[model samples]
Target: MLSGIENAINSVFKPISDAVSGFVFAEVTVFGVTFPWIVAWLVVAAAAFTVYFGFVQFRAFRLATQIARGQFTRPDEPGEISHFQALSSALSGTVGLGNIAGVGVAVTIGGAGATFWMIICGLLGMCTKFVECTLGVKYREVHADGTVSGGPMHYLRRGIAERFPTAGGRTLGKVLAAGAAVMILFFGIAGGNMFQANQSFAQLRNVTGGDDGFLGGDGAALIFGIVLAVFVGLVIVGGIKSIGAVTSKLVPTMGIVYVVACLIVIGTNITSVPAAFGEILSGAFAPEGVAGGAIGALIVGFQRAAFSNEAGLGSAPIAHSAVRTKHPITEGYVALLEPFVDTVIVCTMTALTVIIAKTQFWTDAKATVAAGGPTPDGVTVTSESFASALPWFPYVLTVAVVLFAVSTIITWGYYGQKAWTYLFGKSMLSERLYHVVFCLFVVVGSVLTLGSVLDFADAVLFLLALFNIIGLYLLAPVVKREMTNYRRRRREGEVVRVK
Candidate 1:
């Protein structure tokens, strides 16, 4: 009865969600597309942090590798999971549909140039990841019951309590924390779960053609819901350990498979590699390649890149916060690796596959589609490019996409569960119920027309970034202070011990 009611309520909100999305797009369009500006500002912020952090992401890269490799898996750390598990969990959240379909969208819309910008964003974003995640660990709180609950909220509240004794500071911290919690919840359901499931279904439907025929759309969603609900139940019930075990194995395997496939496609057309890059760099500035097409290439580029790495959107720290570490900056250093893996490496491979395939065989008619009409190929644009280079690629990509989508769903289930526990109390009942609900949505996400839902969810995610970045700025001094303390301990031959 409770689950039914929740589903009804979610259904009821559909119209409101559509209206909000319509309004948001309309408003965004009026300001001459603020997305470009949003992207630019985030790029600048990330860049500035990189400079200020003394290139810590670079300097600490080797140490991070060692940590991830289990060199520091001491049994006495004040956290729940290992460094590898934390990285896997975070990577699962990111290495999803965004890398697959998002890259295709970036290339189609932004021409080649968006790939260049995506790379830039990934490189600089490492610094932003380092700073924010360090704060997450530094200010994380241990509960009376010995459980850990942390993220921007704990840090925001504690940091404000200490640094700004004024009531205004307290109020602002509360407001930001509240806002971030809501955003995280919304993002968890919409982008993390629904968007992924929806795109997976869309791709499947396309691959199967209409022969597989969806149950009436609602019915189709219901079927998806039932299957995912069961699977999510099986994993999440075991909590972080189960989630970690699955993702640790899944993320790296799927990532390598996808990369290898892309390399195969790119190698087939190795001659076009230079031209593909040249086009990307040039197209980014002028967007000439997508100018005559229906959709603006520039819009495609930035949106895809933004969606892929989630740099400014600030959803990653929540996952990173779970790492078992005494030095907050250690997790931060690991966090920096996400965008590099997601955008610069994986996304770049997908983009290259598309461009190289396009250059070799696709016709002009296959290239152009006016703005209102569908793009010449749509999501399979990248796959088509691959198929052009390697005949068996479509099947290989199908497996890769399935792995990406499933791993993403499992990881995001934990994110939503955490947010649910935050909003409601951390009752066992609440945790179980949240998992059930989240899994059901996965099916709904798979079968539904979730394009608008994804957009709305993404918007909420940005709201999170807004709150987090503000808190990050406010607490910047604390982060620096901790770093100095860490460095001092190390330099003094104090042993700087951590379990």
Candidate 2:
């Protein structure tokens, strides 16, 4: 019955998925290495932002840390959440399966060399986050009820109009903003909610004996989905404040736990550390037997980094916009830390663990790919790597995966709700209806394969970067002006420090 349902859904959606995928992932060959044009688009934008901002990721790294720690935050700020909470909310959205499974996929396809490129892409992406998030705060709407709504929709519409201040500018802003909102809502359901739910269920089922356990029963997934949705609904019903509070605690605890687990795996194989680093560095430049050679690795790395940290996608700005800060650029500075933590630190740790563990999963995955077989499941490969060290670690990984999924779902719930309100009126009925529909999709995602559905969602997600990056470029000057003023104020002791 579940298989039939999945097939029916796929039948209805496959054509739509194929069309969007073709357009969004159109490939272009550069120097005989073919890769998605969208990946290059995102990388180019990040690179441009990095250069345009004078490497703000480096110059303001310490300042970002200070501001995120609440050192420069005032209690009377208008936004709903503190700097740390806002960062945590944003981090929870990005630092999920992408860090664990996605890294495994990267190394399997692109070799260990991909890890090097992932780090580099993540570093460059910091500036993109800085730019977009600055404008998110700058153009956000603070409602009479004190709720904040922002992201690419707000920035694209309002920032663009403010920049041009003409009828044409306003029309362009509205069109771009509408496109962004629609894409956000679509991806929030498909990628953020459904994909996470499906993967989390897969991980749970695997850990529970892979079709032999009680959870492998026909109705188990439905039950799991409902329970998950209930938890998410609880948090999201309270809106961003509730999400901020939960994520502020949950993100740090989960991150520290995951990082420590990775450290243990690496520490147990301490002798292999130097050799693993050597493989990463060497493979990055001259990978043997890998497709597209170094360029292949670079493409894979950039793709994974873009997918994992999502710096240019403009989703994080929504969460960051809720930060309680008078100076919008402070949140931008805090935002830069997101890609660093998600891709640079967490993802790098996962990659290092997989490399140091030296599991047979890699060899088998590579062989399967060479034979034109479907890519091996990333979660499985990652689980095998952890289990190679601690035989019981897969259970821990299950917990991590589920937590990651729930956190991602709730953050995206807020994102989608904001988009829904943007499109429809923000009445209580509309908000509740959106939440109900969102949760239903969570159940649907858990019960179904969602093959083409996921592809469609991913395509829409990248499509968001199209509208968002264009808006970012148009508003880059605004961000720079804000940054200049903030820096000048700080230097003149006009910005207060509480911590």
Candidate 3:
């Protein structure tokens, strides 16, 4: 039965896969550079919002830290998880492959310049996170079972029903919520679950050479699937507190360790750092100008950064919405840190490592080409860079990538499950069914070609953002109202209230 099911999925997805390949080659280009459309637009648009919001990502920095530290958390808050855990769970999702593999891709294609753009995107993405998360908490519903089910869908429907009484207004809200839920399911399954598993297995296989039967090649993915299923099942079955407990510990420890490693590599080749920055600044606008004029250089840099940070994808809000706090704005402030950690900090480390590796070992020309090539083997490239800089770097990076990928897969599984339950209803049986299917796909992703599925998933994520941003714009006043209220209370030293 399992073999037959795999065959059926393969046959069904083949045509979709072919069609995506065709699209990637045909439509995505800027001066013969096959750039990713969804990523490109998302970066540009997110930058614009950051600008329009007066660079809130920058302004909100200190406050975000305060909220994360529990300094601002009151004793009488009403929510499922704390601010710290929300950040961790969300960070788990954002910080996984994009930090390791995605950064490698950026440095390869965009040269060091892509790192700069990624920072810009991440910085701007904080504002986007703030808006959606605020709305998520503001309009969330606590079911009789004491579980929370809220996101763009709840906010759109509740916010609209409350504010916009017109028939068309109500209809639009429902449509947008349904659309976001569906997109989340599609994106969560493909990009969040399968993609992570595929990359993790590929890297593990590359290193271990498939020596163990069930742990070899695709078998590694299967084993990974089962392990991941057990861990996630254990945590998610216990609800938010369990997920929060794991992330609270995992996120900070892993995050800080990865950053410190990159700093060592950067310090070793300190001189090249300036030249790397110079290259990034010039190539961001005119890649050809600095790297002898290859449009792919700019596209590669931008696409990798955008993919890693996910500033405008609207997926982060789902995780952020779960944060426990009375003030929605406080959580928004915390959400701002997403891009800083994911893109600016983590991605910077990867790029610096890559850049320094090139200076120390590879030729200028080869490094340049590797920087812009597709399938640049970022994980390997990063490991090579570290090994050159540090004695035991490969082992460390391999472990980091594995952990990062595993945590990421589990987080995405939850996201997809939420989307599934939102659309199909809160059936325990259906949730179990999705858990099994999602786990099974992890193994499949390890063995199969996912380029097409990745493209489709990315498109779905971007589509969610497109719809989500619309709702955000319409409900901007509500965000402002909450922000103002939070500030007023903070100034007055009143007990923080949910209202």
Candidate 4:
């Protein structure tokens, strides 16, 4: 029955996925090497924003840290969550399998040199996150009930009209805003919700003994999905406050454990550290077997960083906009650290672990790709790397994977609810209905293989950048002005400092 449902859905959605993929992942050749135009689009935007902000990520790093630690917090703030909670919630969404599996894929295709480019891209992406998150708070709507609604949808509609104030501007704002909302809702259901649920179940099954485990029975997936959904529904029912509170605790604990695990692996192979760094540097510039040489490594690195950190995807701003602060720029300052923590720190740990351990999985994966075969499973490769040292770490990796997926699902639940309310009007009935439907899809995702459905979702997720980056470009000046005002006020001691 599940297989039949999967086939039916795939048949219905395959054509749509093909069409959307063609547009979203369109390729362009540069200097005889081809890469997705969307990757180039995001990379260019990040670079432009980095220059426009005069490298604010570096200059304001201390200020961002201060704000996140509640140094500048006041008793009476407008938003629902603290800056740290908001940042943690956003990080929970972005720092999932991408940091683990995605990095494995990058190093496999682009070699160890890709890690260098990934770090560089992560740095540039910080400014793009700053600009969009600032605008999110600036244009957000705080309802009578104290709930916040924001993101590209709110900013594109409100910011564009405020800046241009013409019929053309109003029309453009409405169109773009609707497009963003639809994209968010679609991706939230498929990629954010279903993909996480599906992957979590897969990891559980793998650790329990693969196809011979207790969770490998016919009804096992359904039971697992129901249990997972129930846990997720409990947290999300309380909305952003609940999500923020849980993620504030969960993200830090999980992040510390994961990072510590990576450190242990790296420490065990301390002798290989210098050689791994050499391989990373050499593979980046003058690789022997990697495709398209240096340019290929750069493209793969940038793509992985963009997808993992989601710096320009406009989703993080939704969570960041809920931060409690009088000065919107404070949250923006806090927002820049997300890409750093995600791509720079977590992802680099994964890459270095695989490289330092001299894991054969990635080497075999590279050979397979070079021979025009299917890319190997990234999660499998990453797991193999960790297990090479610890021998019993696959169980730990499975636990981490499940926790990461649940955190992502919880955050995205908030994101999709906001988008649903934006389109269908904010009523109790509407919100509850969305939640019910979302949980049902969680069950469906676990039971069935949604091939084209996931493909369509992935494409729509990137399509969000099309609407979001345009709005970010238009509202860059507003963010700059806000930064200037905040700095001047700080200089005069006008901004309150609780600590």
Which of 2 and 4 is the better model by TM-score? 4
Q: Candidate 1 has what TM-score? A: 0.87
- Taking all chains together, each candidate's TM-score versus the true structure is 0.87, 0.98, 0.87, 0.99
Candidate 3 local lDDT, residue 297 = 56
lDDT of 3 at 11: 74
> What RMSD value applies to candidate 4?
1.0
How far is 390's C-alpha from truth in model 4 (Å)? Answer: 0.7
RMSD of every prediction: 4.1, 1.3, 3.7, 1.0
- Top TM-score prediction, candidate number: 4
What's the residue-level lDDT of 393 in candidate 1? 74
Candidate 3 lDDT, tens digit per residue, 1-499?
5456656766776677667545433347566566656666666666665766677777778878878888878655777788888889888888876777677666655556666667666666677777777888888776677667667878877787677889999998899888988888887778877777777766666566556643573355567666655665676666666777887888888888888898888898899888878766766666353333445455565566666766666677677777777677887888878878887788877877877667443344345565664344556667777888797877677777777877777677777877888888887798888877776776667666566567777666767766777787788778788878877887897843232
lDDT of 2 by residue, 403-443 (tens): 99889999999999999999997988999999999999999
Badly placed stretches (over 4 Å) of model 3 are 1-8, 17-37, 210-221, 285-299, 359-375, 443-451, 495-499
- Model 1 C-alpha lDDT per residue in residues 54-80, reported as the tens digit of each score: 877788777667767656546677777
Model 4 stretches with alpha carbons more than 4 Å out: none
In model 4, state the lDDT of residue 304: 93
Candidate 2: residue 385 lDDT (0-100): 89
Compute the lDDT for candidate 4: 0.91
